[model samples]
Target: MSLKYLKIMEEIKLGLATGSLIAGGKLPSVRRLSQHFSCSKNTVIKAYSELEKEHLIYSVPKSGYYVVAEFQHRTNENEVIDFLSAGPDKNVMPYLEFQHCINQAIEHYKEELFTYSDQQGSYSLRVQLVKHLQNLQVFTQAERLVVVSGSQQALHLLVSMPFPNGKNNILIEQPTYFGFIESLTLHQATAFGIELSMKGIDLDRLEYIFRNNDIKFFYIIPRFHNPLGHCYTNFEKKKIVELAEKYDVYIVEDDFLGDLDPDAKSDPLFSFNPSGRVIYIKSFSKIFLPGLRIAAVVLPSLMNSNFLRYKFSSDFNSSALSQGALEIYLKSGMFTSHLKKIKEVYHTKMQTLVEACDSLLPAHTHFSKPTSGFYLSISLPEHVTAKQIVHMLNEQHIYVDDASRFFLPEYKRDTLLRLSISQVNTNTIKRGIEQLAQCITLIDDRNDDRKNHPIPNNLFLL
Candidate 1:
C-alpha cells in the first residue's frame, strides 16, 4: 500500500478510537469525506472498501457504511486498563455466582423457559421481589407487583399509562436520571422539574411544581439518585410522602439502588406511603448484571388493571428465562449472598475512590460520599464545564457522564460530572482518579490563564 493509503487507514482507526465513528455508527459517504479531506475519492473508497472486506465496516445498498464492531487488540497492562474505559468498576461485579445461577436455570428449566411466561412476570420472581421489598421495609404483596425488562422500560410504561387528562403533568428532579426524561418525552407528558439539593429533592420547589401544575405523578430517585449521589433522609422521605398525600399525586419512587446500600437499613419513600399512592420501581441490573434486564414496579391495587394492560401491550412480558433464573437464584439464597459480597466490594471501591479524590483532586472540587449505588457526582468550579472536562478525560481513554446531560435544557448547569465506580477495578480506579485530577488541574490552569489574559476584541472577529 502507498503511504497515502496507510494514512487513510490510520485515520479510520483513529476515528473509531475517538468515537468519531461509534459502534453501529454510519461513516460519511466516500465522496463527502474525500471532498472534506481534499483527497481523491479512490483513496477514501480504498480505505472504506478495505475495512469492509475486513468485516470492520458493512454497507447497505441505499444506506451508508457503518462500523460493525470493535476489534480487540492485545496490549500491555496500562493499555489494557486504558481500553477498559474509566467508567464503572466492573471488577466489583458478582460474575461467577451470577453465571452459575444462569447456567443452572437454563439446564433445569429449559422447556419451561422457551415458552412465554406470565405477563406479570414469573410468579416465583414476584414472590421473591415481595420478600426483598419487605426486607427493605417497604411492605407490598405479590398481587401488586409487575415485572418489566429494566428500569427504563418500567419508566416508559409508567409514563405511557393513561392518567386523568386534567392531571397529566409529571414532576421530576432537575438533573435527574436521563432515562426518566427520555421516557417522559416519549410518552408526550408535560414534566416540570423540581430543583435538587444535598438533602434530596427541594421540598419548596416540589410544592411549587405541584401547586403550579396539575401534576398527577411525581418521579423521584430518593435513594442514591443518579448524577447526584444524594440519599433522602428519613425525615425528608416522610415530608415527601406528606406532600404526595396533600396534593393527591402518585410518587413513582425509583429505588433502583435500594439493595446495594452499604448500610442496608435506609428507609425508602414507598415505606411511608403504604396506601398504594407511591409506586416503587427497582432494578436488578446495576447490582447484578446489566444483561439481566430485570426490574419490578410495585403498583397500587387500583393501578393493577392499568399496569397489567400496559405490560400486556408492552412486549407481552419480561424475559421468562431470565425471570425464572432470577427466581431460582433468589430461592437458592445465592442472590442475597452475592448481594452481600457486592456490597462489600462496592463499599471498598467507593472508599478507595473517595480517598484517591481527597489526595489527588483540588480542595475546591467537591463531591458527596455515596452511601450506596455505583456513582457519585463531583462539583467543579463555577466556570468549568462538564462537557470540556469529559472531552479532556476522553482524550486519555477515560469516559464519564457529563452532569449537564442529566439536566433539562433550561436547567443547564456546567459544574458537575457523574463518576461511576461500577466498571473499573481498584488499580484502575487509582489510575483513573490520577488522570482525572490531572485533567481538572489542566482546565483550572487554562481558566486562570484566560482570566489573567482576557481575549482581545480582534480575536472575537476570527
Candidate 2:
C-alpha cells in the first residue's frame, strides 16, 4: 500500500500520452519494472492488475503483459519508427524459456545461489563459457576467465589498472564505443585515437602510434564495431595482433557481437595471440538478456589474480544467480538453440536495413554495409549536421543516435548517425530510411540555398 503502484500506472499512462509505448506494444516485464521502480514484484503485479481492470493493459499466458489499446486507423505518420534502441528484439527474446531456467537455478542451488560466491565467478559457468567461446574461434580455458558484471566493468577496470609494459597512455579507435570513451574520460586516462572507417584503419599509422606513443593497450572491437558497424578482416586482425606484440602493447579485444558474424572462418583478434597478448571480453547483452549483466573476460594467466583483486574491489563478484541460470541455459544446449534462432533473425534484419539504406539514402550520404550486426552508421551530407536530422526526425517519432559522443574532441564529427536494427521492426525499415533520406535532402537543399543567397553581414546590425 505504498502507492508506488499508482506511480507505475501513471508512468504507463505517460508513455501512452507520448506515443512511445504504442498500442499493442508490450510493457516491461514485472521484474524489469520492479527494478525500475525499486519496488517488489508484487507491487508491479498489483499495478498491472489494476491497469488490466481499467482496460489499459492485458497479460498473455506464458507471455508478459502488454498495452490493451490497438492502433486504430494507423497511418505512416502516426506510427513510431524506432532505429535508436540497441537491445535485443522483444519479439524473439527467450523470456519464458529463461524464466524457466531461472526457476531451475533457484530450485537446484536453493539458498546457495543467494549467498556470496567465488570472487572470480561461478566456476561451473566458466566451464560452459569455455565451451561457448569455441564457436567464435576464441580458444581459452576457464582458469583464465574472470566473469565481470558486464564488458563495461572489465573495460573500466582495465583502463585504471597497471599493465606489464608500464605504459601510461591507451590507444582507441576514433568513434569507438561510448561507454569505453566515458570510462577513459572518468579515469582521466590519456588516450590516442586511430581513425577507423568502412575501409579499415591505416596499419602504418597504427605501427607509428604504438612505436612512438607510450601505449599500454589498443582497445579494439574487431567485429561489428559500435556506432560504425565496421568489421575488420582476418588479415587485419592478425596484423594488428602482430603489431601489438612488436610494440609491446596489449590488445583488449572487445568481441561483444562476435557471435553474429556470418563468416564462419572469421576470428577474433584474440585468436591470433591468445596466450597473453590479447585479452578477450565476451558479452551476452546483445545476443541474450541485457538485464542479466553477465560478461566473461579471458585474461592472461599471470594477470588472473590481479584482475580478480580488481573485480573484488569493484563488486566482489557478479550475480551468482545470473551465473547459475546462464550455466544451466548453456549446459542444457538451450543457449545454442537460442543462438541459432537469433543468428538468422539478426542477419535477416541487418540485410533488410542495409537494403533500405542503399535504396533510399541520398547520393551524398553513405552508410556502413555490415554483414551482420545490431548497428549501422550513416555519414550524412557535409552540409547537414546529425543534430538537425536527429531533431527533425525525433518530432516524427523516428529515433537515431548522434555519433559525436563516440569520438574524442579532436575527432568529433557532427555528420554521423547510428541506427540500431536490433529493436526496430523489419517491416518498417524502409519507411524509416525513406524519412531519413527526405530529412537529409531537405537539410542539404536548405544549406545550399543559404550559400547561394548569402544574408548580408550588415543585416545582423539592422
Candidate 3:
C-alpha cells in the first residue's frame, strides 16, 4: 500500500515536471482521486501528503489542496479573462466576517465539533435554514430539512438511490442543470428530457412524458436555470405543480441561485406543493461561502428515512464545523448583508455584459439579457458552431462555456454559448465580450468568404 502511494506521488511529480498540471490548479479530492486511481483513500492521502512536503501542493482546511503557483513558471503565461464562473468572485465573499463566525464556533462549540454530530445535521443549522427557507417562500419544519455538503450532494442522494415511493425514473428539462444529468448518468437512472425554451417548458410534451414514463421525480431549476438563465413565472410554476400532481410524480426543485435574487412575492414549486410532492434544495455556495459546501434539502416526511439512509451510507454526515459557522453567519444577519452587496455588484456586471454583447455581436447572432441571473445565452449564426466560437475566444485570452455541455449527447448540438457575469468585473466583461464579438464577426466573415470563393472541385485530389 505504501509503495503504491509512492507511485501515485511519482505520477503527479512527473505531471508537474512536464508542466501538464500548473500552479493554481486544484488537485482532485481524496475521494475522487481514490475512485479514479482505484486506490484506498489513505493511499491517496499519503500521495497528496508527499506532494505537499515537496512544496508542489498545499492544503486548505475544509477545502482541498491546490498546486502552488510557481514563480518558476511551468505553464502558459497568458492571462485569462473569465466569463464562465457560476459563483460570485472570491474577493466579494465576506471572508473576514465568515472567519469571525468560524472563530465564534470554535470558541463556542468547543471540542463538540470534532465528533460526528448528526446524520441529518447540526440542529442549530437546521433551525436557521428553516428561517432561511421561509424567506424564499418555502415554509417548512426543521424536521424535514437535511443539511448537506452542497446542493449537488443532495441531488446525487435523491437520484442515486431507490425510492420507497417506487419512483423508477427521473424527468428533467431538455436543457437542465448538467449536474443533474451527471447524477442520473452515475446512477444509470432512466432520464426523460422535455424541451424547455425561454418561453417556459413545452407543457404538452411535459405532460406526455409524465403520462407515459413512470417518472420518479422531475428535477428542475426553475429560477435562473443553469446555462439558460431563465426563471419560471408564477403561472408556469403553478402549472408544473399541477402536472406533477396529476401524474403523481415528485418534483425536486434546485433553487441554487434563489438566494441571489429574492422576490418576496414570487414562490418556488415547494411553496405551491400542498400534497408533499416537491423536494426543495437551496444551495448557499453562490450566495454564501462555496468553500463551506453548505446546502439544505427540504424533503417530504416520507423521504426522510430513505434519504437519510442513503446519506448516512454515503458520508455519514456533513462537516460539523462548516454547518456551525454557517448557522452563526446566517443568524448574524451577515448572509443577508453579503447578498445585498453582491447583488448590487453583480447588477452592474450583468448590465455591462448585456451592453457589450448587444452592441458588439455580429449580425444574425441573437442573445437575451437575463433579468435576474448571472448567465446569458448567445445563439450564434447557424453556420458557426459553439466549438468554433469557444476556440476563437480562447485565442483572444477569453474563456466561455459552450452550450453543448447542457444537452444530452444523443441530442443535436446547438450553436450556442453561455456567458456568466459572476467572475469578471465590468471592465473584464467589456473586454471579454468585445473579443467574443470579434470571433463571431470573424466566423461570419470566413463563412461569407467561403460562399463568395467556392472551393475548387479538385481541392481534395491526391
Give the candidate number with the greatest TM-score.
Answer: 2
lDDT of each: 0.77, 0.89, 0.81
Q: Name the runs in model 2 displaced over 4 angstroms.
A: 1-67, 70-75
Candidate 1 local lDDT, 345-391, one digit each (tens):
77877788888888888888988778657777888876878888888
Ranking by TM-score: 2, 3, 1
Worst ten in a row by lDDT for model 3:
70-79
Give the poorly placed runs of model 3, Cα more than 4 Å off: 1-79, 412-414
Could you tell me the lDDT of residue 101 within candidate 3? 95
For all candidates, the clash counts are 10, 0, 1
Model 1 scores what on Cα lDDT?
0.77
Tens digit of lDDT per residue, candidate 2, span 312-395? 999989999999999999999989988998899899989999998998998878899999889999998886999999999999
Please write out the lDDT profile of model 3 over residues 23-71, one tens digit for every residue.
7888888999888888899999988886686677899999998888851
Displacement of the residue 328 alpha carbon in candidate 1, Å = 0.7
